[model samples]
Structure formats: structure tokens, C-alpha cells
Target: MDTTFPRLLLQHASQRSSAPAMREKEYGIWQTLAWGELRSLVERIACGLHLAGLGRGEHMVVIGANRPRLYATMLAAQALGAIPIPLYQDAVAAECVLPIVNADVRFAFAEDQEQVDKLLEIRPQCPQLSAIYFDDARGLRNYDETGLHALDALIERGADFAKANPAWFEAEVGKARPDDVAAMFYTSGTTGQAKGVVHTHRSLLDRAKAGADFDALTGDEEVLAYLPPAWIGQNIFSYAQWLACGYVVNCPESAATVTIDLKEIGPTYYFAPPRVFEGLLTNVMIRMEDASAPKRKLFHAFMEVARRVGPALRDGKPTGMLDRIKYALGDWLVYGPLRNNLGLSRVRVAYTAGEAIGPDLFTFYRAIGVNLKQLYGSTETAVFVCMQPDHQVRPDTVGVPCNGVEIRVAGNGEVLVRSAGLLKEYYKNPEATAEVKTADGWYHTGDAGFLDAQGHLKIIDRAKDVGQLADGSLFAPKYIENKLKFFPHIKEAVAVGDRREKVCVMLNIDFEAVGNWAEKRNLPYAGYTDLAQKPEVYQLIRECVEKVNADLAADEKLAGSQIHRFLILHKELDADDGELTRTNKVRRGFIADKYGVLVDALYAGRTEQFIETVVKFEDGRSGRVSATLKIDDARTFAPMKAAA
Candidate 1:
């Protein structure tokens, strides 16, 4: 298994040719492919790529959702010693221009008509782009543009080439080296323009096997390839590890049908970010609101019992006889069915990362007997620098360094890592590569964190976002924001306190979600402002704040950043109002100036303040609305004493 991807494919074909290599759900039926069939398909595609003038070290672009053929396209490019660069399927056409032009991409594989249209739209900007192949042919019967071909046409051409030159595919595959570039992943461009992180075969396979060994993953493990393949995390889980462990990676029918497909597949290995988990929890809670009164009562009653006993039982801790008996009954009556409904009944190991997960969300899954845990990594580190082990999961820390990874904290609190998984360099950006990777081989993680007494790595926030309070303790605004937003009542949050005495926040309540909550309780309101100012709604948000504070108290770095006072904004932060960017990301400085009085009120310890916001309608109309906002004090907890 310590080899290149093409070699791995050939090895598996020779060893387990009859074993299932992958699955694709189409037309509501699951289609399976054995290792031998996958190898044959890869060969034909590779031959096609070879005849298309895709030489060694050339770059090809793949875009769209996690379809089986798209995955095959990536493999085919690699099989011909060409690098595959996947662009986010949801990104607009203009956004696709930079990557295609930067990579000097000449060939592209598109999943459907939509992706093909984007490439065509960007072709003038990226004039070097000469060839395009589309997987789905529907709605394209009349698109007779030059250099355009259906994927079946390429395969037909490839079959002819292979027959004429029988030794061509094997010779090309054998020429690939372990250190050859395998794939390139682009950064999210949050901090700056995106850069391509180049990863080699040796690096990708090494980290893949390390993770598989850590989790004891085997060919028997089933994975649902649901997230975008453009993300390094999804690529590692579905592509890299799939080959490493020979797991059965299943592609859902489509994005709209993922939930039904997830239930049908019942995957044993799952991975998602914190937001996906939050959405699932919200849906479950929203549906539960429609149950009969007695059913609701019974569900909550057992959930309380599950919250008490489930985690301890899962972690193999000692429990009282009565608690164990109650947990068993709850499992049979509530937890088991809920898991089946959520499609987690077969989940053996589930992971979350890419952002700080809320403690409440982390606990909910583990409390329901889902082995939900956290890991820490980024695109630059190949997405596996740290990972939590079974029975030792915690929300605050992102476990210890993974196998073959060495981690240390820099003088300014930036975490550093030395691992085989580190990207070789940023393609065509040597200066940027030098900025992160130093001469001593350590990759500056750009994250502020420290190792806890238990040897776990605790990351707070991006080093630039992390600051000290007036009292010289840490303030991580994002961490606090994530915790509050997990409650499902709070939609948007902005924490204020970098060098201040205490922390405060302005919140936007989820109107529909809170309205549903109010209606269930027979509470009446005139509108959003009227509903937000209700004392009962404030109490609900207050309890959520207190819970976040409790979690903060257990972490060494974030203990000082607990929410002290918070106010509900009368209006949502609107991009049209210029309070947020066009991407809907909060414009912090603009809001701070727009509501200067509110900020002063929070720090001045004022009980109330008047705030106003301009509103814009979809019909090109503008108006003004105003309301007096009330700020409430929330209780904070002292830091938990370290275990002796």
C-alpha cells in the first residue's frame, strides 16, 4: 500500500478484483463496480487522456458534485501522470477563471451541462483552454462547439487507441513516480487570493494510511461521498483513504437526493463540518415540534436520560445499575430509532473539522451514541495533522498529533507542524510557499494553540483574530460566535472585546426558527422586533449563553472571552444595507461605526439603547425601521480546576 495511486489501483485489481471498489446511486438504484472493472475503466479513460495530448505533469480541471465518473476522471488524469485540479462546483463562472488561468489548464472534465457552460463562459478569459468533455449529455444535443465532446466519445476513441497500441496504458502508468505531483487544492481565499497547494503521491498516501490505521479502517468500511471533492477533507476521505483502505466509497444520486441516499447507504464512516451538523440537528428538532403532545413529552423525557448516561456508556465509564437500565430502555425506545432516522445507525466513526465545533453540538451526537469527534488540519497540511481517538473525545481540544506528525507552539502562540502530509509547495507562488514553510521543515499553521496537560492540542482561532483582554487573557471572537450560533435560535453573532474589560455581542435571531418556538408556546408577537424583545425569548437566549460560558470555563485559552452582555439587533445584517459584504460575511468595521452608540452602551454598562437600520426590498424600495434594544447580563463560570 506504500505506493502511488495508479500502482494501488493495479494492486487492488490483481489482489481483490472481484471485491466491490465503489458504488454509484442512479435512478434510485445502487450500481456497484468491482476492483477489476474500475481498473479497466481507468485504463480506457487514461488512454483517452493520453491520446488527447495530456502529457506527464500537465494539469486538467475537474468540476461538479461527487459523481462516480468525475472521480474516475481524476484517477484517469493521474493515471496518465497529469495533475487534477478540482474547482468548487457551486462557485460562479467568474470565480472559476482564476484557477483555470493560474494552473494554465488546457483540458477540463465537466459533470453536466451547467459545469460545461461555466467553462465555456470562462474560455475567453482562459484562452489556453482548448478541450472540454462533459459526463452527462442531456440538453446538449445541439451544442456543436469546437473542442467539445461527450465523455462516451472520448472512451470510444480511447478503446480504438488501446487496441492499436496494446502496451500504451501500462507503460504510461508504470512511469509515474511516488514524488510526482498528484493533485492541487486551492485555498478558500478568506485571507487573500487563492493559492494552489501542491501535494505529491508520497505525501497523500502516507497521510491517508496514517488516518486509516488510526481509525482501524478496512475495506469493509462504507463511506458516503457527499461533500464537494474540491475540498481537501472530502478528497482525503473519499479518494485518498478509499484507495488506501480499499473502502467502498458510495456516490449519492445528486445533491438534492443526498438525505435519502444517505439513509439507503447507511455509511459506516462519515465526515462533515460543524455547520452541516447544526443543520441536521435543526431539521430534527423542527420535525419533532410537529409530533403529538404525548410523543413530544416522551421524547424529551428520554432525551434527558440519554444526555446523562449515553456519553459515559459510550466511553466505557462506570455507571450505576439504574442509570444503565434506563439508558438501555431509552436506546430501544428513542435513541435507536432516532439514529436510524438520521441515517447514523451504521456509523462506526464520524468526524468534524474545518471550524471550531460548538460544545453543545458535539455533545448531542455523542449523547445519542454517534461516535462524533473532532480533528484539526487545513489545506496546507493535507487535512490530518491531529485527530481524536475513540473514547477520548472532547469538544475543546482537537486531539493529539496524528501518526508521524510532530507539533509545537511558536513564540507568538502559532502552532507548527512537521509531517509527511505537508504540501510540497504553492504552485507558481514560491514566495508564498516560503512564507509558511520555513527552512527547518516546519509548516507555520497560522493558528494560535497550545498543548494541554493531557497532551491534546487546543486551537483557539486564527492568530490574527486572537487577542488579549485588558486583563491579559485570551479573546477568540469566532469561538464564542460558533458556540452561540449552535443553539438554532441565534442566527448571526458578532462578538466585541479585543482589549476590553469583558466581552459582549450583538445577535440576530433566526426569525422563522424563533417564530416557530414562540408559536409552540402560544406566545404572540407583532413582528421580529416585538418577538426579539420578549423577556421569555431573552431567557431562552440567556440559557444558551450560559451554556457557552460553561464550556468556555473548561478551556484554558477562551475562559476570559465568555459573553458578559448581549443585545438582539432589531434587524438582520443585510448585504444590501452594506452591513455585510456581498458574500453575506459581516463587515465588522462598518457595523461598529454604524452602531457606535450601541458599542458604547455595552461597555458603559447601560441597560438599553435605541438603534435603527435601513431596509431594502427586492422591488428596489428602501425604508427605515427603528427599535429600542435591551441588553441583558449573562452569568459566567470560573475556570474548571485541573484534575489532580
Candidate 2:
């Protein structure tokens, strides 16, 4: 199409001028913007930024929730031939400093007062940050800060600039080329400092169109933008794909209102990480646990049938008449209402990525008729490497290589990919770029897995994390941890058994789910710490661990990876505490280093271990959390046929 994002906007406005382009919820109401209106908005912002000294090739940072104004601001930056860098809005100010300094960002568009405060707090460290424009004007009216302006004011300035020079907008936008740098997304920095993943317009748009075509997405598809725009997956699904397919993108009012907004929008094309899906299912199950006996009984009876026959029906497979009748009845009585309740009733093609989803969780959606599938990709790949085709979704494998993507596995089991969608380079870090991208165009994915006989890609774990046990059998922590997380009561788990005699785990129980279970049994506790140490809770967690072990025993290769001992931590694994990445992926090595004492206790077969650790409070205060956490043993099943 030879299109930049701004050019695509112009085309849409020219072709489908009156069609809905974007919608946002505010004060409990949704306001829609048409394609023509969006084009005008982008032009005005572009001219305004141009007037504000934003020149071609300069970097502008975009940080905040998925607001329409923010999207326009990003396109506006690109319209001026400036590259837009998106940062995680939930990140601490210290984390933001590195990227801003690395990019030498001069102007930024923050969503609201909270985001503005973060930018201001780091202004001293980022002296080059000359201008700041905010979308929401809630708490900034009284502050007298230099170079701080409202987004409305920017638009007004843009309008005046446009009137004065009508040709300037088109001329600036015409300078943008398909191969120009479009956006920069930072890695999660699991091992070290985050790196800026640079992607050109050609790479992102090509993959966007490929995905949209594979799913047959069109303007009629509705998408809810809830995840942080900083993540490449969210950017691809909500931004690139929206422009590629000319779909209607909906922005939630706030994180708190995503569920309500999701239901109201009833998005047809949706994407979420595994954590979101797991949380939703946990909440639904918690509610079901509290339902009256008769209601629960009826729900379970129908759900059992859905679990058996729903996926077969969804995949257009053959089924006996009696089974079909039972499934139809179940859909009417249980599955239909459940899908509607989860805001997935209208979902035609939904995707989960970023991490492996549990089988039970994946099947639940498909079993209830939501075509939820898994995809495999990362920021460097423009987020589209593999996708499960229609009627071929499986929880075990991610999928076959998608259009324009070639995948191969190294002798060490690391997956490698070559695609037009691969990242151009890491900004200012050529050495690091050379490490991942080769001369022949293959990008080392660092994920360990191989293609099965059916050509499906099965991801085991990170190549660095995949290890062998003391007995020379293989061990994959993610494989075992995901099995534990499949149980709604277990929210997060980390397995440690690399080159060890046996595997042990530390986990965080889902507070809400456990609390509900406790309340139902008339058990009382004060808070997370008090509840987590309960003997009954430990027993509950141990049973979940044993179930996973039993499942592992059925697989010959993974049978040796069964968890032998486990403990429920006195605290949740949190990003603020540095136990997890911003995307909530566990930083396994960091956690191991931080809690070396606990890992030692688990291996030593201690029944209880007392430890006090420093924790960062939400308000930036530091305090100590002390607990004598109890460790418990779990039963490991013998494999049906053990590995040689």
C-alpha cells in the first residue's frame, strides 16, 4: 500500500469519511469520532507539533492509557516524520528516565494528571524534555510549570497554524516513507536494562495486514484497547491493525471500567495476555462458587457437557445427534450466558499472547464458543510470527508459522524466525542488535521449542531457563508453573529445579479466590499475610500442586519435572517489588537471588522458615514484612513410561 500511518488515515478519511474510526468512554458515556474527524484531528496536531519545533526524525514519547487523543498524537508525530516511542505508563519514574534520555525526547504527550506528574518528577533528570502536552486537565490548572500545555490548547494552536499555512500539513506528511522509522517499543528487560526495539512502517503494517487477512478482519470488527499501548502486542492489535483494516477501536474510560466498557463495546476482534484471561476466569469461578446450590448444580451439569462437546462443535467436527442436542441445550442454559457475562458474546476472533495460556483456561472459552486462540511473537517481530488458523486452535502448540514468517529451531532448541516484520535495529545499540538479528535476516527468538510433525510450534520455556535435572532428564519450569496456575486458587507460581535433585516451588495464592473459599467455610483471617499462612490454605495449594504432578507424570519427557515441594509466599510477586517485569512475567533469576534463603529452606526440607524482607510501599516508603512461612511436601506420581 506504500502507506505511513498518517497516509492510511488520509485514505480512510477519503474513502470512508463518515465511518466510525475511534470511540472513547468518558463520564460513563461513549463519544465516537468518525474517520474524517480523526483525519482533521491528526492534521491539526501534526501542524501544531510542527509549529512547536518538533522536526523530522526527532523522537517524541507517548505514555498513558489508550485514549483517542493519545492515538492521534502518535499519528501526528509520525505525520511530522518524527518517530513515536511508547513507554509503559505503569512504570516508575526512574524507569522512564533511561528511555527518555536514550531517545533524547523533547516533547511528550501524557494522558492525564498522573502521567504528567511522572514526567514532571523526572524533568530534572531529563532536562532535554522541553515540552509536555496533557490530554486530561484534571489537576494541572494551578501548576505553573514551564513548557506545560493542555492538549486542547495544542489543537487550537494547530488549527491556527493550519489556517495560516494550508500546504504545510500535506508537505510534511508527504515526507514520510514506508521504510521510515514508525515506532519504538522497549523490551521487558528480563535479564538487564530495557532496549529500544525500532520498527519501520513497512514492517509493522505488513504484519498487521497479514494478521487481519488471516482472520478476515474488516472495518466492521470492534476492538477494545485496555492494555498499555507501550506493549507491542497491544500496539499491533489496537493501533497498527486498526489502521490496516480500518476497524473501529474503542478505548476504555479507565482501567477500573475495562470490564464494563468491554461489555458495552462487545469487541469482535480482541487480544489479551494470559494473565487477563486467567483473572477473568478466576473471578467467574469465584462467583460460581458462591452461587446457590441449585444454580450451581445446573451450571455444572451444563458446563460438563460444554466441556465435552463445545470445542468439537466450534471446530465443525462430527458429533453424534445426542451430543449435539446436549451441547445446544448447554449453550442455551450455560455457555451463552457465560460468554455474554464475560463480554465475549460478540467475539469472532480473539487472541492471547505474551505467555502460554493454561489448557483448561484456553478450552473454557472455546468450549463455550469464544474462538480464543494463541499466537507466538515478540516486540522485535512486530508481534506476528505465528497464529492458529481457524478451526485449528490448540493449547499445547502456539500455531503454524503465519503468512510471511519462516521459523526454524536450532540444535539447542532455540526457535529462530525470519520475516519482513523483524525489527530494524535496537536504537543506538548496534552490538546488541547484532546479537539477535543475523546477516541472513533470522532473529534469534530465545524461546526453546520445536515444530511437531503436524507443523505446530510448541514452546517449552525460555532457552536460558530450560535445564536438565540431576538425573539428566529435562526440566521446564514454565511448563509446570502454568499447570499450577491453571487452578483458579493459584494465581502465580515459580518452579526451581535446575540441576537439582528435585523440584520445589513458591507461589502466590489468588487472594480473592482464597478469601472467598475461606469465607464460605466460615474461616477467618486478617489480611494477605494472615490468610496465606493458614494451614488449610497450604493444604489447598498442595493439592493443586499434586494435581499438576499427576498431569506431568502422563508425559514421558516432562514426568521428571514434577514438583516435589511447594510453599505459599507471604506476599504476592509484584513488579513494584522487582519480583516481576512490568508485563507481570516473573523475573526468575532475580527472584531466586532475592529469596535465596527461601529456596535453600525448600531444598533443606525445612517445615518452616522465618524471614523478614524489605518491601517498597505504594507511596515510595520502605518497610519490613516478616513471616514464618510453612513449607509443605507434595506427592509426585510415577511416570507411565519414564525417560531413558
Which number leads on TM-score? Answer: 2
Model 2: per-residue lDDT, tens digit, 273-391? 99899989988988988899999999989889888998888888898999999988888888888889999999999999999999999998999999999999999999889999978
lDDT agreement with native, every candidate = 0.88, 0.92
> Cα deviation of 176 in candidate 2 (Å)?
0.8
- In candidate 2, what residue range of length 10 has the lowest lDDT sum? 613-622
| Per-model tally of clashing residue pairs | 0, 0
Query: Candidate 2 at residue 41, lDDT?
Result: 94
Off by over 4 Å in 2: 642-644
TM-score of each: 0.87, 0.99
RMSD of each: 4.3, 1.3
